[model samples]
Target: MNTPNQEAPAQNGKRRTRLIALGVAVLVGVGLYGSYWYLHARHFEETDDAYVASDLVQITSEVAGAVTAVFVDDTQHVERGQLLVQLDDADAQVSTAAAEAELARTVRQVRAVFSQADGLKAQINERQIALRSARADLQRRQKVAADGAVSAEELQHAKDQVAQLEAALNISQESLRTTQAQIADTRIETHPQVLAAAAKVREAGLALRRTRIVAPVSGTVARRGVQIGARIAPGAALMAVVPLDRVWVDANFKEVQLAGIRIGQPVELHSDLYGKDVNYHGKIAGLGAGSGAAFALLPAQNASGNWIKIVQRVPVRIALDPKELSDHPLRVGLSMTATVDLHDGSGPLVATQLRSEPQRVTINEQRDAEVQQQIARIIADNAGHAAL
Candidate 1:
């Protein structure tokens, strides 16, 4: 059997060895964590609370009609100005035709008014000559009646003829003035009546063109709710077109983590769809004005009893590179992880202003040009040789 002293010394040494090993392990763990925090974590702010976003361009009918045909379906790619839907344009066409005919008829009618005014002018000239001749005849008859060379009845007839011719001249002059007033200071094309009819034609043309719904922008179709023979009204949400090329990411980070975050800071994003293999490079576009909870439908009442402090998240918009987006498309609402590099701390926390130019612009060149062409053609067809 071993002695008590030997047994006590051996047990003490074993206990000392176990304590030293535990201390070394603790030191190693702490050192590794410290290195990680210093080398990789501090220079960036990361969050998994992020998603892809885009402007959902809702396509609706400007005019109401039954859907005659649907050219696009859900998930189909469309180009700007491409026809996506066609309404039953029977009524629009008839209205357009009527407007055109009205415009033509009005132009001719205005021309006829001008002609009538000219005819009235000629009649007035003829009446003036006749009045002069009647007056001369009355003077001659009066002189000869005093010399007993003309009868009293004949002289009276000559005097009456002069008065009648004078009255007729006055009536003709009034008629000419009235007729000239209608055609004065205006051409056939610029006449008020023709202009009014032309406006109606433009309105009808716009209505007819609106019956064919075209894509406002190049994008992918979604939420298509229209079908053949379906009656739709103006402002109805028939579908939406999402521009994948112009998508951005909205990253929500905690309030505490918002420090040092600024506009123009470089950001790296990884979508859950592509994992970490595909990286998206972007820059901070701007930060949200307020936290989500602040704008929520039902906000928290912090002043009430049993109030618990919660971290609020503010959204940060990040614009992606267009070329990258074209190569690797990201759909709206896709989950993403964003890590913003805090190395460049020179940017502003809040954008004070935006660019002078608008981010999105709409042009009506084609439709406007078509309507202008139609108006010109109608005016030309009915304007005749009349000066416009």
Candidate 2:
């Protein structure tokens, strides 16, 4: 064995070798990381302050009625226009019947007014003929009176008859004018009174249809608030439907990170619901108009002296691919990690164009169409052959 001094030097040499190796390893790691960051990492920004979000379409009653049936519950999937609740429609039925009857009666009344016009026209013709005859008779009597062949009393009587016939003719003409004014410049369907009644009928019919509450979107139901026997008024919330397929991420990034972010930039998201195994690809849809704190219920008043500088975050909306969203559905409020690619920095800070897809209420149009058909049927049934 060597001396203690020799042993110490050997151990020191090994330790020095190990130290050199460790230093070289650390240097290599740093160089590799710097290269990777320069080549890849620096081109992206990441934030864990993100969440899966979607529109919570609330189902509300459009008319007041008592709930008679609840057809759906929480967590159930529903299709658009699917009936989800039913209200007792007895009152609606009564009101609709009354409206229909009123429309029919009004139609009949208008038809009578039109008939009176025809009768007035005939009366005017008759009065005109009688007036001509009397004037002719008076002229003949005046000629005879000049020759003293007819008495003055007889001539005066003939003049009085002519005057009375003329007055009758004027009255008939006035009656026809008054009658035509009521129905002028409009058809039976477009008549003022008829249109007014038809509006009431449509209102009542719409209320009746409103008694059957339907889902406005296809999604899973949540927050079911309706129950049997519950009296719900107009605009009362019944439930909410969440469309998972349309879910997107709301990534809140620090103001400093927003310098490179732009609309239409590609985003890679990892949901906490599936952890790091599953990935979602999307594009930046839009940037929020204001920071979250700016729009808070009670926004921070920086006018005070106790203000500490806190980094603000602005929400960036990311729209995911439909196929990816379908394959891996996301729920609202779920945490997510979003990484935005800044490689292609050629987009606007805000969306330049309006959304291509917009929410449309086709069901309302259908309801209105149905109401029109009903009005047409009512008018056809009541409008008579006496159209003038």
Q: Pick the candidate with the highest lDDT.
A: 1
lDDT of 1 by residue, 1-388 (tens): 9999889999999999999999999999999989997997888999999999999999998899999899999999999889999999999999999999999899889988888887888888888888899889888888888889999999989988988888888888888888878878998878899899999998999899999899988999999999899999999999999888889999999999999898999999999998899999999999999999999999888998999899999999999999889889999999999999998899998789967677553435677789889888888887777677
Q: Judged by lDDT against the true structure, how good is candidate 2?
A: 0.90
Task: Please provide, for model 2 over 267-335, each residue's C-alpha lDDT reduced to its tens digit, 9 standing for 90 to 100.
Answer: 999988898999999999999999999999999989988889999999999999999888888889999
C-alpha lDDT (0 to 100) for residue 113 of candidate 1: 87
Clashing pairs in 1: none
Error of 1 at 338 (Å): 0.9
TM-score of each: 0.82, 0.87
Model 1 spans with C-alpha error above 4 angstroms: 1-40, 116-176, 359-365
lDDT of each: 0.91, 0.90
Best model number under TM-score = 2
